[model samples]
Target: MFTKILIANRGEIACRVIKTARRMGVKTVAVYSDADAGAMHVAMADEAYHIGGAAAAESYLCYDKIIEVCKQSGAQAVHPGYGFLSENAAFCRALAENDITFIGPPVGAIEAMGSKSEAKKIMEKADVPLVPGYHGDEQSIEFMKNEADKMGYPVILKAAAGGGGKGMRIVWKAEEIEDAYEAAKREAIKGFGDDHMLVEKYLTKPRHVEIQVFADQHDNVVYLFERDCSVQRRHQKVFEEAPAPLMQNDLRARMGKAACNAARAIGYEGAGTVEFLLDEDGSFYFMEMNTRLQVEHPVTEMITGEDLVEWQLRVAAGQTLPQKQDDLSISGHAIEVRVYAEDPDNDFLPATGTLTHLRPPQESAHVRVDTGVREGDEVSIHYDPMISKLIVWADTREGALRHLRKALNEYQVVGLTTNIEFLATLAAHPAFVNFDVDTGFIAKHENDLFPKREHITDDALALACLDVFITRDEEAQAQADWSGDPFSPWHSTSGFRMNDDNHHELYFVEGDDIITVTCHYRDEGYVMELPGGDVLVRGERDDNGDLAADLGGRRMKATVVRHGDNLEILVHGRAHALKLFDPLAAAEGQDEVSGSLTSPMPGKVVSVLVEKDQEVKEGDSLMILEAMKMEHTIFAPMDGVVADIFFNAGDQLEEGVELLKLQGE
Candidate 1:
């Protein structure tokens, strides 16, 4: 084992590698950029160093800086965790030239599988099953359209140099090819610094199943079973599970064999995942091979009881395989869901904010949360907005799903939009619970997945009122403890009625609605008259701060948190964010709506398609903004003429900053 290793990554993966290195008694050196100076990974490492600016090109992807830091910290090896320099053959080669070990596959293997186009060619020659498409050096959009015309209507154009739903576009018909080609090319150029693309015949309803393979320098390889990554949105996976639900033993063996063969074909070593698109007819085609540890590797680890990072280190240290193919077997089922600071209702656009409050589910042997962020950490727009990976395990798939849903329900995140509720709903959905899912799961069941917007129920308000009453009671008791004289009625916040009935009013704001909750003190409880009607509520908070109470003659359990200025309450697995309406404060108001088109989020203006005084109809593209490596186009809300343009292409701006102004036609 290396005495000390440098992690060439950030966020959860860096912290993940650090954890395993510490377990192995190996010291870790973390490299951070300007944005990640106080990041969790930097604080967890034994040694830390500043690399460069906040941009990935200046920091994580800067070969010279990483190399210099590794040498300075006396790190004998570098663990490039999954992204940035992970699959870069040149970086691997550079590490070799510096006499440092690259904790991944060799340069030859990376080169062979680095490009999706080249990897498909090699897989086809190696007798791996392949989908019918074009995998040649074709950059011309017209050429790509012709190839798609031949392959059929449904073809996916993927970046030749990268993956992760970046630089990828799915064209359903010939009419959509031109716009898709332009957008895909633009995204590819920005994401990978490459414009080359390869077209693949997109399967209509296929399950994305990937086989995890590990190899050692002694030519030994073993597959740690398969992960079903079928649930996705915008071509990126959201839920993944190990051993692939309903997978037959024979199919698992065959797929595992094919994956190992592909690894051996490239002389691969360390951890690699060979992805396949499992068709409806039980047939599977090769996708691309990830040449490093995956973001969802925890599912595999939970099922197989293996530490893949430790395996990567041992393999890099020239050790033999830890477990042979015959010795390896699945113990249980595991599922992983990525909790990102993104909005599921808005094309899953990444969010950036300070996590005013972050509380994930408690971890145990059955549930694990791998995260690099703590409460109050700023989720920067300079990188991915993933908050954590929640992994759960059980003896059966059903039990694992139950665990997953429960954990998701207990998870709480404030101050930013999250997909937690969406994930919880999807986890408990019948189709997913029944294991009938594919890549088109989200789109096919959009109605069920997205769901109708939930309203603030009277029951929810009752719970919130119950919480408020309980907090007041606690505060009164604390005041009694702090007062010099205990019998002072002036210091008592408790509504101690001598003869007349005691009543008070409170207000809560939810969006445009202001609900008035009137509390009438009764027998040690209060009757709250909120939105729907009056409801009797009384609750006692447990040690965990969870309230178990009787509301409106019904038993209920709830958790209410005072996060910042809002009150977040979770009841019956649903969450509601509310703000206390202050009557004494300044009156609330809203700005007048104008013909000003502003940036919805902090990002760089990619392109300005319209000039000043340009006439446009509704839905006409005005400009493109790139944030978190994804491009979002600003469209004219109504038929209008452009009055002025404020920001030019390549200018970075903050959220709500005016990009252009328009006048009604």
Candidate 2:
């Protein structure tokens, strides 16, 4: 094994590689940009080095810098954990020229399979099945449209060099092809820097299944199993599962064989995944090949009882296959859901903020959380917004789903929005529970997946009031303890009642609505008039700060965190963010302003579609904010004239910063 290896990636995958390297008695050197100076991966490595600027192009994608760092740190090899320079064949070649081993496939194989268009040709030549489409090299718009017409309507245009579903557009009609073609080309050039594309017959309700294949220096190859990743949104997978649901013995054998053959065809080495689109009739067509470790590899690890990173390290070290095809076998069902710092209700836009509080689900042998961020860490706008991968294992699929739901419920995060609730709802959906899913599952069951907004319950309000009342005492006690006076008189004011009839009122702000709750102290506890009806509550903070409440004789427990005026409560697998209302501030009121379009999150303004005094209708695009590598458009709220413009095309703005203003008539 190499004494030290340089990880050419960031976020959770970097941390993941560091962990395995440490276990194998290998030292790790982490390379970070300015944005990741204090990142978890940097803190976990044995030694760290600063590469370049925060942007990927200046740092992670700069292969020369990475190779130089490897030389300086005496790293014998480089592990390109998915994305950035992972699949760039030129990077592999550069590493080879520098006499440093690339812990992935050789340059020849990567170049052969790097382009989706080229990969399809190779797969077809090797007798592997392929979908009926055009993989030609013509970049002319007319040629693409003609190919789409030949393939029939509902054709999908995909970037020749794309992966993870970016730069893809599905066209359902001929009239839509022109606009879709331009849009797809723009995105492809912006994302992959390759305007070349291919047209394919888009399957209406196919499942996205992939086979994980491994190869070694001795020409040995093995396919671990299959994973179904059909639950997707905007063409990207939200979750994945191993040993595909409803997979039969014959189908598994056939797909596994094809996967190994595909890997061997390209003389591929190390760990790679071969993706395919499985039709409803059980027929499968090859997609593209990922030439590095995947984000969803943990599900395969959980079921096969193997560490893929460990295997990658051994294979790169010129070791033979760890086990043969006959020796490998699946044990149980495993599922993985990507926990991202995104708002599911807001079109799944990336959310950036400091993690005021963070707590992953309690993990055991059967449950795992792979993350790189912790409390007080910032989810920067310069990279992907994914926080962690939650993996669960069980003897059966149903049990795994149940455990995943429970784990999501137990997960805690504050100070920013996340998709935990959406994931929990997805795991509980009947179609998902029954294993009846496809690429369109989320769209088909949109009503069930994106639930209606929920209101603050009366019980939650009562608990919040009680939490605030007791938290003051806790703070006082801590201050007294710090001063070496644990028996301070201020601690005795909690629950202090001059008489049984004493009463007090507290206010809470739920959005724009102010809720007033009157608490009347009594010998037994307290009775308060709340929304819907009157309820009695007796609650107190435990040693761990969890709120233990007895509401109307029913006991409940919750974890709470407060930041500024915001109070976050977690109870019964649900989260609620509320604010403490200040009536005095309301009395000193400020005027309400409208007609201003501000950024919902911190990001760079990619485009300004409207100009000053320009007439626009409702729903028109005003500008686009690019954050976390995703673009979110700001729309005009109503028909109006652009009154002013504050920022230009490439100015970085903070959250809630006004980008433009409009005057509506």
lDDT of 1 by residue, 580-659 (tens): 87878947887855999988778899999998988999999999999978889999999999999999999997877999
Error of 1 at 13 (Å): 1.0
Q: Give the alpha carbon lDDT tens digit for every residue of 1-665 in model 2.
A: 89999999999999999999999999999999999999999999999999999889899999999998998999999999999999999999999998999999999899888888999999998888999999988878888888888889899999898877677889999999886776677677778889788899999999999999999999899999999999998888898999899999999899989999899899999999999999999999998888888899999999999999999999999999899999999999999999999888877878888889898989997789999898999987789889999999999998898889989989998878899999999999988899889999988999988978788888788888778767765777778888887886655534556655577778888777788998876667678888878888888888877899999989998888998878998887788878888787766656556898888888888889988999999999899877655567799999999999999998998888888998997
Alpha-carbon local distance difference test for all models: 0.90, 0.89
Pairs in clash, predicted candidate 2: none
